[model samples]
Target: MNRILRVKEISELLGLSKSTIWRMRRDGLFPAPLKIGPRAVGWRESDVTDWIKSRDRLQ
Candidate 1:
């Protein structure tokens, strides 16, 4: 199963602030997070990795 990364982890991985990540998500510039629980959400590891790869390609 794919790992689900919470906001903190994603922020660290992307070297971005949590708010920045949220803004990117809201602006449709980042991958949408999955609803993992009643009040929690996370992004799929694969999805995040793919987003990184796509960014690399764009550079």
Candidate 2:
């Protein structure tokens, strides 16, 4: 099954600050999170992995 990752996990995985992730999301540079709860959000692990792979191709 596909996993969902919280902001902390994504931040640590990408070595980016949570604010930076939020900015990226705002700018459409990152995938938008799914609303997991009234005050919680998460990203699909596959989406993040695919994003990383795409970044690798660009570099």
Query: What lDDT tens digits, residue by residue, belong to model 2 across residues 1-59?
Result: 99999999999999999999999999999998999999999999999999999999999
Q: Give the TM-score of each candidate.
A: 0.97, 0.96
Q: Predict model 2's lDDT versus the native.
A: 0.97
Identify the runs in model 1 with alpha carbons over 4 angstroms from their true place. Answer: none
User: Each candidate: what lDDT?
Assistant: 0.97, 0.97
Q: What TM-score, to 2 decimals, does candidate 2 have? A: 0.96
> How close is each model in CA RMSD to the real structure?
0.5, 0.5
Q: Kindly give the number of clashing pairs for every candidate.
A: 0, 0
